[model samples]
Each structure stands twice: as C-alpha cells, then as structure tokens.
Target: MPRVFLSFRKVDSRWMRDRVYQGLIGRFGAGEVFKSGESIPAGADFAEILRRQAAECELMLVLIGPAWLEARGDDGMRLIDRADDWVRVEIETALKAGNRVVPVLLGDATMLPEASALPHEIAHLARLQFLRVPETHLAEELERLCAAVADLMPDIGHGSASPTAPAAPAAEPTVTMTAQVSGGGSAYQAAGDQTIRLA
Candidate 1:
C-alpha cells in the first residue's frame, strides 16, 4: 500500500480534511494514509514531522479550500508568504522527493497570488489531477476522492478479494439405497437395475 500525506489549511478546512482522511482510510485501510492531525506526536517538531512524512510518502494530497489562499497562521502569516509554511514546505518536499502530488479543490477557491506565480517546480501541480467537491454532497465527493486515491495508488485496491466473486458449485449425493425382501432374510441393496429381481 502506498502512503499518502494530506496537506491543507488547518483553520479553513479542518472538517473537510477529516472527512477526506476518513474516506481514505475506508478505501485503503487506516494504516496506508497519514494526516498531520492524526500522525503528529506530542512534543515532536511540527516542521520536521511534515518534511519527514512528505519525503517518505508515495503521494501527497493538497486540499484547496476557499480560505486556503488567504488563511493566516498564529504568526499572522499566509502560507504563500513564507516559503517554509508547513503546507507549502510539505508539497515542495514531496515534489522534490519525486512523489506524486494531487491537488484537490475543496471549494471554488483560486490559488493565492504568490502560489499562482510559483515556478514550474512548485507549480507542476497544475498538470496533475484535480478533484472538486461541492459542499452539499461531501460524502459523495469523498467517495470520488477515494476512487481517485485508489486509482493513483493501485495497491490500495489490489490484493483484496472482489465483492462479486462467483458462487460455489452445489454438492451432489454419492449414494442411494433400497430395501429388499428375500425368501429368508431382509437386506439393504444399492438402487441399481442390475440387482436380481426374485419374486
């Protein structure tokens, strides 16, 4: 199974992130997908964890929401402002590490100005697959997302038994018997025409 790292603006799309995480787990099994919210350990360095996970993952999913382009952190800094915003850093690291990056549009949001102007190295994401989820149909949207995840990381669906396998053949009885009355004794006999008919 391929490991996937999810990057999103925490304050802007926390709920959607969680939903995506659940959907991924349902499709790929819980251990195959990793999210910062669930995988980060207490007292761990946040930036280092993000970088390490990005490097190790086989794919990275960027959740783009309405406020993603403008959401500010505790330091009042937009991710596009600092080259090292955890989200931006994770995406860049994943790209440099030769991992696939899929940008998922959560709402009708556009990329931030700085992000929009990023070089091909950072903007290579524009050519990758993008999925848009309408807010009204989140569950359905999540199913679509899971399908895409399974498609990109085929191992998620591989090696698993299909839900629609053919049914097994019915068994047949191997023996039949008949009661026979003889002149001096009663006996059980096989139900075959070859038996002697003594009257």
Candidate 2:
C-alpha cells in the first residue's frame, strides 16, 4: 500500500484537515496514513519528517479551506508566499517526487489561484484538479474520496470496508454421456443418457 500524506495549513484549515485525516485513517490505517501533529513525536524534527514523508508517499491530499491561500506566517506574509513555509515545502517535495497531489476544497473554497498569484515552486498547483467536500457532506465526500483512493491505488485494502471484487461467473458444469448398444450388426444406438456435475 502506498503511504497517504495529508497536507494543509495549520491555522486556516485545522478542523477540516483533522476531519479528513480521521476519515483517511479509518480507511488506510494509522500506520499508512501520515499527518503532522498526530503522527509526529513531540521532539521530532518537523521539517525532516515532512520531507521524508512527502518524498516517499504515493499520494498527498492538500486541504484548502476558505482561508488557505491567505493564511499568514509569523512574519505577517501569506504562508504560501514564503518559500520556506512547511506547507510549501511539503507540496514542493511531493511534486518533485512525482507523487499525486489532490487539492481538497473545504467550506466553499472554489479553486486555487492562478500561477501568477502563487510563488514559482508551487505555482503548478493551481491547474491541478481538486475535490470539494462541503461541511454538510463531509461523510459522503469522505466515502467518495476513499473510493477514489482505492481505484487509484489498488493495493491499499480498507480492512472490513474494502471494495468487494465482482464475483466471477460460475463455471459451466461438466457432462458425461453414455450410450447403450445391443449386440447387433446395426450401428445405431439407443438415445444416450447424460450426467452433469457442478464444479
């Protein structure tokens, strides 16, 4: 199973991000699902861990809420504008590794900004297709997201919730025919009896 990475700005989309993380964790298991804060040890190096996870994971779900783009850093600049921002680093790492990045829209987040509105490193994010999950439809959306993940990454089993493969058509039964013939010169034989056994 490919590791699934959850990426989002901490202040702007924490609630929705946590919800999405919980949903994915239930389907992909805690070990396979990677999220900051939840999976990291208190003393771990956040940057190093993020780089490792982003480089290794096969898919990254970027949670973009209404305030995501405008979320600011400690220096009062937009977080996405800062080249060293962890969120930017995570996205850049994943993109460099050629991992799939899924933009998840929340609370009416319509679409990402155009390349001109973003820094060069992550500008490509603007054109990627995204998934939206309105708060009211979170559960339904999560189910759909899980289905998409299953389709994209076939080896990840969702425990008891895994999609069932279509049952193969039953094999045709085998038949044996026997003909009874009288000891006569005529070559004709009585109608044969047949027996069929289901496999």
Backbone clash tally (model 1): 0
lDDT of 1 by residue, 1-199 (tens): 3388888877667677778888877777666777877878789998777888899898888888777767766888666567766767877899999998888887545443343655444777766767776677788888888887777777663444223357897765555334467678966555443444444
Local distance difference test, candidate 1 = 0.72
Per-candidate Cα RMSD to the true structure, in Å, reads 5.9, 8.3
Off by over 4 Å in 1: 73-77, 108-115, 119-121, 157-199
**Model 2 spans with C-alpha error above 4 angstroms:** 158-199
Model 2, 10-121: lDDT tens per residue? Answer: 7776777787878876776777778888878899998888899999998898888878788886779888888788888999999999999988887654577677887899
For model 2, where is the 10-residue window of minimal lDDT?
190-199
**Candidate 2: lDDT of 197?**
32
* Range of the 10 consecutive residues with the lowest summed lDDT in candidate 1: 156-165
The TM-score values for the models, in the order shown, are: 0.70, 0.75
Cα lDDT, model 1, residue 157: 39
Residue pairs with backbone overlap in model 1: none
Q: What is the lDDT of residue 118 in candidate 1?
A: 51
lDDT of each: 0.72, 0.79
